[model samples]
Target: MTVTSARFGYDDLRGLITRVVDVKHAPEDSTLDVLWTLYDRVLDLSPERLDSPDRDRFYLSKGHNPGSFYAVLAAKGYLPDAWLDEAFTAGSRLGGHPDRTLVPGAEISSGSLGHGLPLAVGTALGLRAQGLLKPRIYVLLGDAELDEGTNHEAMAYAGATGLDNITVVVVDNGSASHGWPGGIASRFTAQGWSASEVDGRDHDAIEAGLRGHHGTGPHAVVAFATSSI
Candidate 1:
């Protein structure tokens, strides 16, 4: 059964994170703030209109660590709070990687790196083809995942095609083995994308970064999780 409660809020996210203890990485420290901000302020999505064609789509590319993702979904009443307790257990819908078919609010079944961004691009194109222009697409990925050539190719294609309906959030915890020379934002800017860097932990800064871009092409937000895991 679905559980929606007015009592769920930002403060309750931590408790929900603790319930899912099987995650291999502590990505919650870096991603929780941004996840909360997106669900709370940026994305035009909710539990009620999850299947609506006009609803915004958020693809979690960095799916290896989904504690914060699930927490924000529950906090925003997208899924039952009891499901968090059963995460990664036998028969539980919540798995190590999010499955779109199983999870109520997940837009894509993501776990493999370098796939979500491309999939999001394809989805945006599909939406445009269907004349569903009101919806926006958001994809969140780890900095380390940028090492994949497919991501760069996808960024170039999105930028070249002027896919303005898509936005990419890169959570940078300094995890990239071979870092970008001019910074992560430069990688996108070079490919004609509007890019910006912000303090990942600052909600206001993150909100601004997410909404600051007004380019005709896609936008990228490099959220530096300097003080986080």
Candidate 2:
């Protein structure tokens, strides 16, 4: 049986990392742990749903934070917690970036931004071909990742394909340095895609954005967040 997360809030999950970091006497990467909890709960609480062929798929396009992702996967039982301590410690499957083959639940080896969305198009198309229309495909992107030209290509493709079974979660931390281009939301709309902005730090808002869609075409969820990790 798979272990499910207890619907803990982000703050609660962050607190867990604070305690764990203190116990392990390793404070350097504790913030990463908090981020991992999101994946942990996502995988756990929604395991059965996710595992099903008709269930939704999550493509973690932002792979720079694989450490936190691995740690959470471990906590959720997909990986070994020992890997957390030994993480990036040499000769470990857990590296700075996710290797889909090595990480059981990871959908892609995503160090490069803008790649997952395009690939997600293929997955979404494949699933549609298979007649699995109930579940959608979600791609998680970091704010800085928008710099990749491929993302723009993907946005255009999604618009052209009219893929209603696709959604993108933009984890914007406002630290992307260059910041997202102005009129991003409008741009997506002009391309025949639906777009919305939300507070990334607000769990409720995030959940709402993910749940409600126009069923017209692809959707882009821009989440504005400020993460210390």
Candidate 3:
């Protein structure tokens, strides 16, 4: 039974992330652990959702934080936490970047900043080609990732193609990773996309934004998160 992080408010989520981040030097490691915790505690979480033609797809574009991703998977019952100890020790399945073959729930081998969303768009298009339209593709991007031209190209393409099934999530913690002027949402909107700006730590806000969302084109969700872990 997965516990909906929903029950926990933004403050609570922040606390959890803070704790995880403080516990490790590598924020990616902390994030992986948190993802694991969510998996373990959250109900009905599974990568199997991706297998069904009608199910949703998610791509973590901020693949540098493999530790967080891995942890989340382990918590969700996809990967074993013990793997963390072993992989970090040797040339193990777990590496600095995500290896989809080793991690079950990870949708793509994400490390290249701008590739995840494009890959997600492709997946959405592929599913659309197969006549599965309702299920959408969600991509999580880091603030720093915006600097990559590939991401902008992907966003522009998504807008031009009118990919209503594609959603772009940007996690911004006020970091200088990307030259996000004013705000990322505004840039997305300028690119002809419907954007939603929210507190990344707020589960309720996140749920609302997600549920209330109707992607006419590629929707960009800007999450102003302070700490990703």
Of the candidates shown, which would achieve the greatest lDDT relative to the real structure?
A: 1
lDDT of each: 0.88, 0.66, 0.63
Q: What residue pairs clash in candidate 1, if any at all? A: none
C-alpha TM-scores of all predictions:
0.94, 0.79, 0.79
After superposition, the stretches of candidate 3 with alpha carbons farther than 4 Å from their true spots are 1-26, 29-50
User: 63-147, model 3: which lDDT tens digit per residue?
Assistant: 8756556555544445555565555446577776777776666778888778997788788889889998777776777788788
Flag regions of model 2 displaced more than 4 Å.
1-12, 15-51
Question: Would you list the clashing residue pairs of candidate 2?
Answer: none
Per-residue lDDT of candidate 2, residues 1-229 (tens digit):
3444333433443444442233343322422422442463332235444357866677888887555455555555565455555556567777767888776667788887779988999999999999988878878787678778898898898898799999887766654666656745666787888888876656566666666579989998777665453
TM-score of 1: 0.94
Residue 196: error of model 1 in Å?
1.1
Candidate 2 worst ten-residue window by lDDT:
25-34
Position 53, candidate 2: lDDT: 84
Local lDDT at 136 for model 1: 85
Which 10 successive residues of model 1 have the least lDDT summed? 20-29
Best by TM-score: 1
| 24 Cα displacement, candidate 2 (Å) | 16
